[model samples]
Target: MKNNWADAMRKNVHHLAGSLGNLLVESFHYLALFAIGGITAWAAVMAFLGMMEKGNITVDDILLLFIYLELGAMVGIYFKTNHMPVRFLIYVAITALTRLLISDVSHHGPADLGVVYLSGAILLLAFAILVVRYASSRFPSAKVPDPDATVKGALTEEKGET
Candidate 1:
């Protein structure tokens, strides 16, 4: 009974914490929207200046914009789903890693390049799996229930069903 009381108290504390955290986060999101606007304007100005100076846009520099785009997309998805899918995070990480590798590969050789390529391949496979899993869950197909697996008796099978 004492342990049960402790568990109940712990749950109450967590519930209070979650409630307070949600309020604070929502307030911050509203306040931060103004900052986001200013930052986006500054980024656009910088991009325009860089384009004028170079006479052409470098894809390397555009990767920075891509990063910001991913951030905005992530926030957008969060607002839409109240939960962002892990695939977007994986895609963001993959792009960031690729950007880093591309920026630094001037001093790298075949072996180092191979390692980077392998890492990218692994991340790609993981991202693909995540996408497939998400698709399957979102569009579930007809599936038969397992034999002798009732709502409660999932482990213990019926005596004659074996």
Candidate 2:
């Protein structure tokens, strides 16, 4: 009986520790999300102010805004679905590279320009690979169920419907 009591106490403590760890992880996740959101907002505001001061939005400025918008969309999607889409990151990278090329063309030599273009091409290839991977999947992983659908399913079950 003493051994059993000790074992029970140990199990309970282990379970409590696991729960606390999960809670801590979730708390940090939310904190990081909030930080991303705040930084994105700051970037957007700064970009807008810069454009306003210049009285004209150049292509580079517009590309920077596109990057900010992509980052915001990535955060919003992750917040809603808990999934980070790689395509958005790729899109942001492509935009940033294009912006760099456009802004630095006057300063870069022929070799530097070639390197930038090569880098952009490589990123485009990666994006193509991702698209192919997604398209060629015969059986995609199950998506997270919608909360409303879950509730409806439960209600239908309680009403004895199949």
Clashing pairs in 1: none
* lDDT score for residue 123 of model 2: 76
TM for every model, in the order presented, reads 0.49, 0.72
Q: Report the Cα lDDT for candidate 2.
A: 0.82
Candidate 2: misplaced stretches above 4 Å?
Answer: 105-123, 126-136, 142-162
Report, for all candidates in order, the number of backbone clashes. 0, 0
lDDT of the candidates, in the order given: 0.68, 0.82
lDDT for model 1, please.
Answer: 0.68
lDDT of 2 at 58: 84
Over 67-138, each residue of candidate 1 has an lDDT whose tens digit, in order, gives: 667766766676665555566676667677666666666446445656667577757867686877888789
Q: Which candidate is the best by TM-score?
A: 2
Model 1 root-mean-square deviation: 11.7
